[model samples]
Target: MGFIDQLKTEYRVGGIVQRLIFWNIGLFIIPMILFSILKLGSVDIGIFDWTNPFSDDFFSLSSNPVDLLWKPWSVLGYAFLHSGFMHVLFNMLTLYFAGRLFLTFFTQKQLFGLYVLSAIFAGLVYILGYNLLPLLVGQTAKMTGASAAIMAILVATAVYAPYYEVRLMLIGTVKLWHIALVFIVLDLIYAPLDNSGGHIAHLAGDLFGFIYIKLLQSGSDLTKGVSGTIDFFANLFKSRKSAPFKKVHRNTTPPVRNSAVKPKDVTQKQIDEILDKISQSGYDSLTKEEKDFLFKVSK
Candidate 1:
């Protein structure tokens, strides 16, 4: 299949992780391309430069709390943006790995909710740290990237399955917590060196991830609120599709059923059976024909 068609198919079936990745990548790329074209055409757009997401006042989170009053969406919007190529690349790669690990132990809704909530939490922490910390006094900074959300997923997964092992390229297999510790330590070490605000945000994400899992274990699902809010808004904007018009035909003769006749089309009962099998044994357990039938029905 062509790239766009393949993307569409994958998006339809790939669940929330893929959707999140698509969103981050789209948010980063589309604006860059659009603004580059506009710049080439000699069109001057003031202040909000798409080339540098960090410089964009409208979306990227600022160190000042007062900025939040004006750009409240930045709490979550910043997580979907990146300042540069490497910024987005490593973030997305980590997200793919961490998000998959998280999904193995949690629902898609929980993963998504944790991501959004953690990003907001981290943004708030970033603002608070900049204002309250004596060392950060009189310093102004802006932050952007999915690193905060990605860190939350990574740390949350590790906290839940500390012993889970995964193989690395240069390095051998290591425990999930080992990986989480390494990243957390790096953030701590760099918090005072460079990109301090970003590092602070990462640490906040790590903290939220740990707290999120603890609360979840105690039977308090923090993700439910985020999921419910998203669902309500989704339902609010969702358009109701009308059924297509069909012509009615009357036949004088009655149809006859033959024992020798073979059915060429799939039935609702067959679809339900396949769906039940999927729910019981997972999508990978489906046979080739079953997979094809399901895909066709989805289309």
Candidate 2:
């Protein structure tokens, strides 16, 4: 397949990690492509420079309360943006693997909820930390990149499956919590250094992830609202995609079938086993029969 076609195929069939990576990479690439075209023409767009995503007034947080109030979408927009290549690279890499790990223990909807909501939550915390903390009040702290969101996935996976072992090259086996704790401690230790605002935001994301899992374990799922909001928008767009059927006055009752009814032999035990398989491997690892069973159960 051609490059673009391959990308389309992957996006259509790939997991959430692939889609998230596509968005981040796509956003980063667009600005660079624009810059290249402008550079070839030896032209400067000045105020019309859409290439500079960070320079946009909307690409801000509580560092400037007035600006943030005016551009509220910045909270979410900032996560998809990056000020540098290394920045986007690290965040996307972390997200790609962390998402896979997160999905092993939680639903895809839950992962999506954490990724988006954690970024917003982290941004808010960054703002609060900037505004409330006397030491950070005078400093300029403009946040961007997907670090906070990646951190959330990292922490969520660690918390959900603390003892889950991964056999690393040479290192043999290591627990998920061990890796997660190292990152958390490093952030905490480096909070007083330069880029403290970012470290603070990362810490906030870690906190949110742990709390989210804890609440989930306690029967208080924090992701339900986010999941519902996502479904609402998804269905809204899906509704627009389908051609409407003309209403007929003489229409009879809709056909019914045994499809709505489940076989008595397909017990909850079977479902639990399928779910366990998903947790150990992934949804993509499910057989065709398993996939069909899941689809029917979902319906």
Candidate 3:
């Protein structure tokens, strides 16, 4: 196969992470091409530029009203902008693996929520660290990368499937928790020394991911709020559906049956039986009869 064909086959946009990587690379390429054609070589369309958080150019509510409106989007945009080939490669690889791991156990809605929240926290940490730290010594530096968000997904996956194992190129299978520990340690130790802002952002994202998973175990999902926000805008643009509040009344009475059908009550014993089956044989192992019974009872 030719080089272009090989590239297309390997990296064709399909899953969420793959599509995101494609979009990022496309954005970077399109701008460069446009600039080249228009002879505007000096223009920089890169979303995240290294600017002092305290500087007038930084997105801050106190600094400028216009910038404040734009600040929230920067959190998302920064994830797609990379300074070099290696930067994007590393970030995309991390994203692909972490994202795949996350999707193995989470719904797309949950993954989307995790990504957005992680990116937001990462940006917040970057801003706070750059602005408040004396270690910066008033040096104006801007941070941008998807590493923080990728780290968040990685942490969340570890929390969700701690026993899941993956084989490395040289090493055999390794538990997910071991990988999580290594990242946590690296972030904690190196965060204060090199790329402090990025490290801080990563930690912040990781915290959110971990907390989100823990909350989910209790039958509460943080992603529900994010999904609601998406639904609000989607409903606004699309045609409105009839509200559930409307009442419908039937005028005619139905004929009575000779024998009355009794509603089947699910007993505690039956529930225990199902639970035991699930524990021993797994959810997918349940027979059709068992599944139907469980489904009806669940309702």
Candidate 4:
């Protein structure tokens, strides 16, 4: 396959998290390229200009509530736009780590919903902080990045499985909550130093993650709203079809069995037993054989 074709294939099967990363990277690069070309042609469109905070840019959430009236999409669009190379790099890396961890015990729908909801929540909180806080009053700021959504995934995973162990280079093994706490502490410490809006958004994401998991534990799923909205839009774009009329026919041929095909060794009973063990304790409670069996079954 060609390079572009390979990338398309990867995006098709890389799961929701990888698709999200691709989206962020694409939005960042495509706008920059379009902006450069437009500038060269002396075309000054306010929509493509990221430097002007009050301009009609498609991304970057502004602190001014009045600006939101014209750029409502920025609430979620900002998460897909990055300020710089390092900004995208670290955010994408954390997304990969936290996203994979979150998916271990959750569904893809939940992850995507949490990401979207958290970003919107964080953007609103950022704007509110800039507006009401004594230290940030009268300050206007525009923020863009995936840090808030990434933090939501990370914090959600830690809350769901606090004791989950992850080994780091030179630091050995540590619990997931340990890593989550460190990030939260860093955000709190840096909120007053610089990038205060970004830090506030991160904290907002952390709060949303905790709330999402707590509600989930109480048998309330927040992702259902996201899923339903997605389904509605998807169906709106889909072409309707009618069932074809068919006639039933009788056949006298007997069924044939292939001797070459072997029956599966793993049965539903065995799978249920393993799942029960995991539920009663944790994934670590499974034996080597059980883990191997589960892995193979998953494949």
lDDT (0-100) at residue 252 of candidate 3?
Answer: 94
Residue lDDT tens for model 2, 31-145: 7788768877988766544556565555646467667768889888888888788888988888887988887877777887888889999988888888888879877768888
TM-score of each: 0.83, 0.80, 0.65, 0.78
- The lDDT per prediction is 0.86, 0.81, 0.69, 0.85
How much is the lDDT of residue 172 in candidate 2? 89
Candidate 2: C-alpha RMSD to true structure equals 8.3
Q: Give the per-residue lDDT of model 4 (tens digit) for 1-299.
A: 47885676456446788889999888777767777777788886654454432223446799988888988999998988887778889999999999999989997778999999999999999999999999899998888898999999999999999999999899999999999999999999999999999999999999999999999999998989998899887766653553356588887998677676545533556766876676445456689998898667555
Q: Give the winner by TM-score: 3 or 4.
A: 4
Pick by TM-score: 1 or 3, better one: 1
Q: In angstroms, how far off is 91's CA in candidate 4? A: 0.7
Clash count, predicted structure 3? 1
**Which has the greatest lDDT?**
1
Which ten residues in a row are the worst by lDDT in model 4? 49-58
Q: List model 3 lDDT by residue over 169-284, tens digit each.
A: 78899999899889889989998789777778888888888888898998989888888998888878654664747788885988676454443333546655875666444455
The reply for model 3, stretches above 4 Å from the true place, is 1-13, 40-70, 240-299
Model 1, range 1-299, lDDT digits (tens) per residue? Answer: 47786676566557678889999888888888888888889887777675774557787898888998999998888999888889888888999999999989998889889999999999999999999888898999888998988999999999999999999999999999999999999999999999899999999999999999999999999999998998887766653453357688998989886766445433656766876675445566689998998788666
State candidate 1's TM-score: 0.83
